[model samples]
Target chain A: MRVSVIATAGNIAGEALSNKSVVMFDILRASSTISTALANGCKEVIPVIDVEDAFALARQLPEGSFILGGERGAIKVTGFHLGNSPLEYTASVVKDKTVIISTTNGTKAIRYAAGENGRVFIGSLLNCSSVAKALADLSKDIVLVCAGTRGKFSLEDTLAAGLVIKDLLKFFNKNPWQAKTQEHNKFYLEETPIFNNDALILEDAAVAALRLAEYYWQSPIQGLLDSLHGQKLLQLGLAADLDYCSKLNHLTNVPVFFNDKIL
Target chain B: MRVSVIATAGNIAGEALSNKSVVMFDILRASSTISTALANGCKEVIPVIDVEDAFALARQLPEGSFILGGERGAIKVTGFHLGNSPLEYTASVVKDKTVIISTTNGTKAIRYAAGENGRVFIGSLLNCSSVAKALADLSKDIVLVCAGTRGKFSLEDTLAAGLVIKDLLKFFNKNPWQAKTQEHNKFYLEETPIFNNDALILEDAAVAALRLAEYYWQSPIQGLLDSLHGQKLLQLGLAADLDYCSKLNHLTNVPVFFNDKIL
Candidate 1:
């Protein structure tokens, strides 16, 4: 298996993405929010690129069927029902509701991945293990897309990506491919067919992420606190949000982007 | 001052690069090769992207005035005088002669930086301290361009870039900006005017490099040996070359791309 981590969504090569499965990490919020909403029983999360588009999509849905969500400059958009905070998404609030979301970085990456990749999976610190398990099961060439802050690399996303890579290595080491294929045929036909994991090769970007994860494995929150977006969120009194996003492998749901929605 | 480390030459934004002092790093071994040639009394090194262009430029130069040098798949060009090996460039061989070089990655980044940046500098393990000193003197925004393996991030160049950024941080901590501006007036007026380094800000890409540097500080060679390009070089019995490229702050000559030549 070959894995590549794109440092930022801005420079993603569209042609290269189509053949590979993409897992996007916007650990500061978007990925976390979507994952949480889905875990809490949201029917689907529609990631739109623009706030206007989110509004338009919401208007088309029945009044109680959807909730307007997302952020601009780390704050909830005016008239939106919820902000881009995973903590804001509760089981009672998101149950069977559709989330129409737009965010500064994550949604753009999600949309790009949606258009370019056949399999677009959402990941964050909250659900990285689950994400890794799903990817390793497919055993296809994968690309981890980091929805970087304003077209620049974000440390938070890279850390989450590293964690996923770390977990993937563990899974590959513990389970033989022959064993995995027989047991996990759940999405084999619809998505990628299983391939033997004889060797796992990580590209340079992925290597960097894995190294960061190893370095900060002792105290991952410190790394998040040191990130550009994390610092901005801290300044905006969203330390709790950062804390929420930093929880590792706490969620079991993998919100996969299929047919223009994350479910 | 703000600093950014571009993971690869492929995704460099032209507009952002123009105002920043771009430092190109191709650790194994274009940057190291150029630094060695310059330190050994070469007149100049002209970096061209294509082998055909290198041949065309060499043809234009008077015979014996310049030597055609560079590599394709880590080997010297068929008709060139030297390969992309720093060890090949010694005082007796290259003194008082011009080097027209082309490489798989390094030269392309050099050409792009030359076209876009007002000031283009070369860096590697051999001359990272020199590069950092020169950048600190300028006291302007900087973009550390890592000429990655093949349109992807290379760990060797990232580690080198990290070493430079680490040194830059040291320079800021040890000396006041006002003092630096007084002593280094050589390229101040012609290029970027010195600014106060009261609080040097590093972009996220730079932060990643710095973290890598900190992680590998005790065993820098191990990091290089672990890189994809480094492994390939080792397989070809270029272990000595990797060891040579891993030397930190061994060279004093800072190669600057000025008026079409790295001098």
Candidate 2:
């Protein structure tokens, strides 16, 4: 099975990944937030590219059945129920509501991939290992699509994509695409030495898992709450349940986005 | 002094380099070639944004007294006497010649900075240290304008800019603008370490400088010379001179472009 990791959806020259298994990542919170919302018993989360679509979706959902959430330039929209920060969501707020999200970069990237011809999965560092496991289990071609910042390659997004690549490498010898992507990642990783800069990789992972677990352990989504995307959620006051979501493998529920809905 | 580096010319939000010191880097041969042409006895090098403008400028020059040279996708213009590789402008070729040159990205960047304020010095790895010295001497304010890949930040250009920052730190404490630019570059430098892995610092500097020194050296611009941009140049048959232009600090000449000509 061939597996490839595209740096970003913007650079997809001429529909290259049309039929591949595509996992999209927006680790600075979009995918993580959606996963969190669904895990916390939200019926569904609809992503829109712009503010108007978000407003339109909010109007269509049954009255009092949904909450509008998302941000532009890291700030909440006026009068909206929420902004993009993941830390604000709690069981009291999202237990039975739907979420309408509109973001600057992530939603646009998601829409672009959804338009492509393939099975699509929402990805984030929070559930990166799980997504990699899912990719390996399928034993087919895959493309890790990073939702970079504003139509350009971003450092944070690329690092999360690297996490997926690192996990998938445990299961298979890298194909040419995988090799190039890995080489590309290895280049950057060597520069910062950020991951291994401090002691105890296990401790760091454990703490990250714990933080996520604290937020949404029982809600279903777990482990992702510790990712870079997850931290941003904490800032937004959206997912006060972030600590519960950090527990690694607590729910075993892998939320997969298919042709339309996520299951 | 406030010193800021524009990550890419595309991201220049306001006035570009007005009443300030700005260094422009098109390290993959354009600025390096221009530097060499000026240093090696060229009478003048006129940079035009489009090929038509170059032709127009050439026609205005005295008949048979000037030369036309440059590349579109790294290849020589049809029927032109020279290509962009700095090595092609040895004493026999460019000395005493007023050459008209245009390239895909660099010329556009130069033209883009044409009307803006401040002194503009063409930058390259070949003149990295000297450029730093020049900036230190000016000691007012500085902006490093990266001639990025098609108005987007590419690894090579940003890294070269970082190299400039690293050198500049030796002479002065980073001012507020330099601090911000450094912060921005830290992200890109950390993200593209593969381009610098295991390579000696001087070797890395020379990698982009050697383009002009290519005929002087026996090798070609080896090792991943075929990138999206590099391949464009190769397809135009401009690949052979890449090695010469990629060398570091080979041309101690710093061609200052202000008003219109390379001084």
Candidate 3:
């Protein structure tokens, strides 16, 4: 399909991005943590834009079913059950719990993209393969929405998206037969220069992407607290959830949003 | 020197531009045209934000001595002296005249950076070497302000900034500078990776910048009308003066802006 990448949310909110299958990415922590929690065994990850909403959601959850997670500039929120570190999201800690996530950049991006018509998959390098596979199965036009820091593009986020684009290209090549056998291969691939780079054979490029992916797959949320931007969050005392956000496949399911709410 | 880049005016106002050595680039035309106009032998180029203000300035100027020029979306403004095209701004047409100029993105950027302190120079690849030398001589904190199309960072502006950064690194290598330059010297040089990359070396970069500079350097007012953003100004029917902007010299002159005026 026609896959247009808006470098920043601000670029589209007031200008373009309408009726697109938006894939929102905040690679440093938010998206990675969400993917990890869901994969490990978390029930649902509810992303809130503000701290008040996060606490409100945690309070309303059925007692032990929910865990408060997320960061404010990388530090854990006060009185919260966890911080933003993905390492803390272990099988023992979050085996079957709902997660309340709130961060400065990621949630706001989700809120913004929620206005569009197509499916919004929480994307990151950790879940790049699965997300791409899901998109291929759904086979619809996709937009890799990068949740840039504030209103600007971030190097980390853009690179992560490059990974997603890279993966989708690979998926298309490996599954030439899946389309003939399955019913979900209806989406058309849009030719773009961003897809031409041959990073698969390059040792450094492959290692870098895989390392970044593996690092976040388990301790995804924790990765955010350590980043240049994440440190700012930690200094702000939003560190509790940092540990909890690091686990991979903690929830074992992905959270999809459409029109601003969980779908 | 610290380099701050503002993607658009929508993110901040003139106050945000206040107190910095700003290099404003609306590369599609304003900076290019302004640089071009000065290079081609124009009087001082006056940049006005509003179209009505440009018209008012035009009406007040002495007749036959001035020309009104600018554009709106690649088209000429009605009731104006000329359209926004570098090819049209020849010295024969613009010599010894006061021209009222206006444009969409470029002039707005000029207004924004002009409101700040320190130096404010219109930048584009046409004057890449000149802009770099000027910034290096000043050696103060610098801000690369891109007058993004509408309010988003287009591919054109960032690449242009990378070009300026590329030149600064080269200039640094030749200069017998003092200590404490290591950190910034590397940073200034690092941006060159994108500029020097084989993938981006195209005539569009230099030609676009040169066209803008030539347009602005010619009939100072007509040059101002040569930006894509300038076209937006023309469409609104705002025309400005050319007599105020001066000619461009081979030895780059650092336009110092203090007290709301470029020196």
Candidate 4:
């Protein structure tokens, strides 16, 4: 299957993502937070584009049934129940509650990708392999959308995308189908997956992302600490969030965003 | 000596490139062609933002003293003297003649960068080291502007920027300053180059560009041939131009664009 990657959500147009499976990555915090909340038994997550929308959605829900969780400029929004840190999204806090969230970058990306009629999956280093396996099972063309920081390229998001693409490639490589011969001694093709030599096109951004992943694969935490946004978060006293987001394959829910909620 | 990279010209605002040394990279053809023409003894190359401006500038010049050279959609402009290929800019044709040029992407980038009061330099793989040396000698903050194809990221331009940054780092690494001792057995500091530790900050895009250059340092030609733009040129039967642009440090003339002319 062909896989393409966009370095930021601002680079995507509505028509480009039509009829494709899209995986949104914001590994610095948002995607990881969403995956953690879902994996911890949160009923659902409503990702709104703005803080006003989050408050309005929360008000509409039954009292005490939903919590407002979001951040602005890497800090918890005024009057919000929780910030974007995945550490705060534990089972004891988020269990059986619907979360109406608004983030600076990640939720906006989800809203943008939700414009097209495609299956939208939340992806991060926490559930990269699970997301890759889910996409492979669909056997459709995939587009990895990186929720970069405020319309600019972010290293963490791009590296997470690269990891997803690399995992997909490895999955296909190790699970190649084998052909069997019949009693009549006639050669026949077995039921194989979609494998076209020319169909697997790699865009320039995708290649760059893959290279970035390879370069920092051995020390992802240190790589995150060295990134531009990572440094900003460090200045904001969010080192624990960085360490939490650095874990690979720590979650397996493979959260999917559908009908304004991540399930 | 901070270095920041913009993946595409669209990301740049009016104030972003002000008071900096701006190096524009369109390695596939436009910047390469401009450097080649200047190196081949052309009087000057005027980069215009539109084809109409190119034609107007040519008409204003004395007859037989100038030539209109440009391309639209990878093909030579109608009735122009040359296309956007460096191979077409030989000494015999462009020597002592003013070239009024416009391309689909490169000239637009030059125009955008020229809006601010920065020193604009035309850069490509052909003159990467020369451009890096020139910037290092100036000791001003550098901004590498990639002339991405039609508002999208192009691989060749980013890789070329990375090469320039890599060379500049090497130049500084090898030429460290030495202190002198006075007659009274006291040490005196020499006039060293700008060496502030925090001043040489690398943005995320700049770091990515550096990593890309390191990944493809050994096989630059193959790297170019494998780029998205390179594949398009091959389809258009312009592989020869790709070969010409792939040569690293082959030209020493660092063509600087000032006052509407590349000299």
Arrange candidates by TM-score, descending: 1, 4, 3, 2
Top-TM-score candidate index: 1
Can you tell me the DockQ of model 4? 0.19
Cα lDDT tens digits for candidate 2, B120-217: 78887678768878987887666777786765443344445545655565565433122122222213222322112222111211221221122112
lDDT of 2 by residue, A1-263 (tens): 44444545665554756666677777566776777777678777777777987898788878889889888877887767988755556667777788778887777777666655635778765676788788778766666676765554333444455456556655654331221222322133223211122221211111112212222223322222212343344446535344433333333345666555555
Candidate 4 per-residue lDDT, tens place, A202-228, comes to: 677776787777766655665465467
DockQ of each: 0.22, 0.05, 0.04, 0.19
User: Candidate 3 lDDT, tens digit per residue, B1-263?
Assistant: 44455655455556655554578766566666665555566665666666788789888878877667787765677887776554456677776665556887677677666664534787764565788787777776556777777665443455456456556656545221211133322132222222223222212122222222322222323322223333344445432311122122332533333343333
The best candidate by lDDT is: 1
Q: Give the chain A TM-score for each candidate.
A: 0.89, 0.69, 0.68, 0.89
Writing each residue's lDDT as its tens digit, candidate 1 over B1-263 gives 88888887877768978766889899999999999999999999998889999999988989899988899999889999999989999999899999999999888888776655546899998888888999999888888998898888898899989888878877766331232234222222222212222468777788789878876655566667557788678667677787788888889888998888889
Better of 2 and 4 by DockQ: 4
Q: TM-score of chain B only, all predictions?
A: 0.88, 0.74, 0.66, 0.89
Per-residue lDDT of candidate 1, residues A16-75 (tens digit): 787677898888899989999998888889888888888888889998999889999999
What residue runs in model 1 are displaced by over 4 Å at the alpha carbon? Answer: A174-198, B60-63, B116-118, B174-198
- For model 4, the superposed segments whose C-alpha errors exceed 4 Å read A60-64, A171-197, B171-197
Tell me the alpha-carbon RMSD of every candidate. Answer: 9.6, 11.3, 11.8, 9.2
TM-score of chain A of 4: 0.89
Query: How close to the true structure is residue B246 of candidate 2, measured as C-alpha lDDT?
Result: 50
Better of 2 and 4 by TM-score: 4
